[model samples]
Target: MKNILLIIIGTIMLLSCQRDDTEQIRIKTKELISTHFMGNGVQWSAYPHGDTENGEWGKLMTSEKWEMNFKRLDYMKPKLFRVLDQANWRYMVGFDSDGEPILDFHTPEVKAVEKILSYAQKNNITVLFGEWGTPYKMHDLDAGNSDKFKGANDPKWIRSIVAYLDYLIVKKGYTCIKYYNLVNEPNGDWASTKGDFEEWAEGVRMLTAALREKGLDKYISVAGPDAVTRYDNPNSTYSGAGWVRETAKQLDEMVGIYEVHDYTEYDLVRSGGFKKYHGDIAQLMAHTNKQIIFGELGFSRNGVENQERASRDLYACEDSQFDVFKFSYGVDMADAVIQSMNAGYSGAAAWALDDAMHTCGDLGNKNELKRWGMWNSLGTELCQNPADENMRPWFYSWSLLCRYFPSGCSVVKTDSTGIEGLRLTAGVYNDDITVAIVNNSGVDNTISLNIPTHKQLKKFLYFDGDRAVDVNRFPIPVEEKIDAKHSIELTMPASSFVILTSLDY
Candidate 1:
């Protein structure tokens, strides 16, 4: 009788412990966010200054390097690609004595652009291509030129832009170039527009008229205002959100898409402040019937400190972020994407794909290269460190997002965890669902996902010491198959990102 009582008591204690463990899990239900999840991707640009004489892209374009990079891009399966360029870099050489706007479409620079467009064309990638700004007056190469290019309003500039688009779409057959952005970050005082809304609007008007005249309007439409938010000087007169509102009001007819740039602070994202802040912008643009995308997205943790550190430790550029080297950067970026999607952003393109794409101030000096990319393609040539070419940790999380967040899927928001630094965003397409959960806090949290799916899910995890990758550095599923019929419960490790998707890669 004593042995029987002891066995029963021990069994009861075990059952109680199991029940207690089950009760401790944090349960949250997924809610409908938006049925208009346009897409998600990264900014990929042509390398005009990448040569030994100019910068790092020449080496990256080699057969071997190109193959390696394209393979990785293929695996990522990016849906949207933002490609920005300058006039002088590709076709526009200079104006004639008569100022007829000299142009050449068969230059080596144009060929380099074709390489990018070819890939997008073949892979069916939606490309948002544009010039950096009013190309002539912005650069030192044209400082002494007699051309009086009136920013974007210049007739010559408008004609040149339209002609370039015509050549790409009508001649080269790259229908993949669906949208054209006139100026990048027109709201910033640093941009060519000098934050002049009237000037930018006039430019947009002129470009639209010219596109119609050249019959290129049918092929591509304008995307704006490509303005950056938050990082703008506090005392600045206009904010990025202000620019979007203005664009929607003033150029509603001409604009095909509404977009903005964000280089948010780490706290803003991890604390769930970004969603509320940008959510207002998304709400404001909802009535427009066009999609809003984050044209350029990056993390700017302690902006001044990161800038100072980038100058002191790595490259000597004033406009660079070194946090891309940290694993936590990936966690924060994943959080940003989740928040953006939940906030009604149809799509977002992460700041960049390769460090070799740009130099500080567009100076073309290899030493002043921007350090905000997944990897420096010129690591071997410019930095003399082959290891610099290796993929940074952030690529793991970002790739999963790009690969899994297919275009045209509905992005669903979940009920807030009420747990600081934890976020969830789900993509639902037909009967398939891909859910991403991010925990940017210091401690682990038990999460019971109340998603409506019973299909087998492939789980991919990103954490400091828990990530598993193949020899190619691509993510390997932690679990090849897990039943998701009932509520899915799992422990989200600290500073980690977890993706549970019903779709196979």
Candidate 2:
């Protein structure tokens, strides 16, 4: 009886030791994914999404507010920016006596554009500038509009927009406008093209010809098809992936860069389904020699229901996600970024930079502001709450990504450790390296990262209660210098991520 009791105790001890060892051992193998890391950033539109009557954009542009916002942007260090605008907002005013479009480059709206572009120019940021849709129309079925531009393909619209591009790129010397997106999400019925692929293609061709004719093609190339995924149209069966494949097959030559938008659900991102979903699309454009990017990336929980709930809670627009207020959104978004980089996407721009940039219907109503921004710049004027203007939790993780995974960095992938909901992506820029690890599972994970670099790394943690922020709300490194010559082991808490970078600042 004594011998049997001792043997049982020894077996239990051995099993417990094995279990602990298994929990502590997670060796990740790093591999080179791509040498070209185009960039990562946010959609920073010119002018507020609402009208100027509400003082949305105006208040945000004030000396004090502008300086504060500039400081935040400076710290984020975004290398790619998408500036989407409406035609009537800036140069396109009205048609002339002969029905020709009238252009004005000196309006306040244009000045707002200059503010955005000037910063992009100064900071070497790649600007993907574009129009939302047709100048004065949302849906094709709408009537009572006197705008002469028939559709995106309208010869008049194409010529007018190209002239506007000439003023900015050639005349104003804002050479940072590297690509021009003709229309936003032409695959959707809500767009002016009304999911008419041929119509949108014709417009793209016309715009491309106009750019070439005006010699602007040398400076800026056309980027499309700016489609979005999971767009449910009861009347049509078209999908964003279908749009991309067709664009690759049909409008291959006219397009310089292929791009799309995705508002994925939490399960897709957390379960690593986003990698396969995006990888299939990335494969479509592989032969084109031009890189593909997510022009607008975001999250929506249960689609319209989730957005409506967010609207009720915030008393804002209906098409926004409440998850932006949660730390989980940051973890999920980081997961998406990891998947995107691993899936062969060149880059991704977050849905928006500020909630003040748009309203639900562009009606200028303060109450209708979209709630998908890093922060609301006009929160004080619109929501009467200054706290709404502060950076949300996602900014910590995202800004770390934007600052460290800069343009021209080589994106490195890693072999999976068979750990559910744990992901790793690295970027190497010359001697500097940035490694991001995200744990999306409900349980904690102990990961051993094997990165082959001798540089000292700055570790930034974005857990629920452990985020370190400075006075400016920018992410401060938890550890200033972590020696990365050997394997680095750390515990990644549930719904959290960590960034290890050699680049400081």
Candidate 3:
């Protein structure tokens, strides 16, 4: 998920006041929406080095009482989840050992997987085992035997793991768990660990082919989270040929998707941090022939008034050019899905379930780490519990885009607002057309809009501002009118995101 410069925005009124128009919905005063973004997921934090492994969470997961996390499975597993995209199951276990078997999947202590998997299936969330990560060498292997490229890095081990994953999808009656992440963070500091991008890409390529032979040809594959790179920086290691770019080239014939992590700004977004990692990846994937995913992302709420310094808050996305970067979850979801889909991405996930704290922890800010959860942060400065839970400000922003564009929707072009401070993107879902308008100004401003597709427009959601309103609760009031060709116009707000969805007439 790359965030390039802002798009162009001109004051050209979409419709003239003199135009005769008649539509079902009429224009009204500025409509406000608070809560919108809604979703939950389980990244591999509970696993060994990570958090959610075999039921246990955090330090508890790696300790003797690992099953403790599973005990709470029935109560929390499927509470309200859909995209159960297990990011590091295979990687956390590694390629040296026999994957799941080595991870003790057979152990009665780890039997909760059946319940978790069953719940995900019943709830309709597509189950995606994020591509596994390999180790730099045999020594890097976790004592648990999950790291790749170590002493036990036998090709036979690869075959077994692919076969095992295939068995889960086929024998288990699952059609949705069809994608595979080839490598996780295959770029960056691999050299020090005796691993490099070329080797990693080749290894992932072998695994991809192996999986195909194991009868898993339909599994879509992803590469990267090529750490942070500067599209503008020449010495920047990110722009250099990395695993994501290399692997996509080798697997050119395979039906697959190119992916990467978009946390380039880290936890500085709340301080108004900005970057073009999302757009740069989109451009990079262009040659590889694949869609993109931000992989993982989180905005800072630890700044002034919990909004932080502009230098730190990359969550609101100050980058003007792109509009598809969604936070955390890896399910290819969000408003940018429509736009990113047009760019090459089919969808994206929000990067996490209850691991908000983990994401914050990585930022190295203990205080901010607690505020990362979708529910509430541990700091109590942002979110605390269900009572104050209304989806973070970031969630609403995603709803402004994802609420309208589901799978199968084609992205449409916008009229182009050539302005640096504003960003506008449009997409079509079924017969409906949706426009996402964002004004990245610190202060509020007013602007006119032009929607050529529909005769009437209704505001779907607005992310940002002082409201915690959810998208489902309120529908933007549509003015009753239509232009000659049935075009509709409306007023938009400042530092706000207004989503206009088409109604089936």
lDDT score for residue 206 of model 1:
88
lDDT tens digits, residues 102-169, model 2?
Answer: 88988777877788899999999999999888887853322445356678888888877888888999
Question: What TM-score does model 2 achieve against the real structure?
Answer: 0.91
Q: How does model 1 score by TM-score?
A: 0.91
TM-score of each: 0.91, 0.91, 0.62
* Model 2: residue 66 alpha-carbon error in angstroms: 1.9
Evaluated against the true structure, the overall lDDT of model 2 is 0.81
What lDDT does the true structure give each of the candidates?
A: 0.81, 0.81, 0.40
Q: For residues 219-267, could you state the per-residue lDDT of candidate 3 as single tens digits?
A: 5343343333322223333344353454455555553544444433322
Clashes of each: 4, 3, 83
Error of 1 at 45 (Å): 1.7
Pairwise TM-score winner, candidates 2 and 3: 2
Relative to the unseen true structure, what is the C-alpha lDDT of residue 223 in candidate 3, on a scale of 0 to 100?
38
Cα deviation of 64, candidate 2, in Å: 2.0
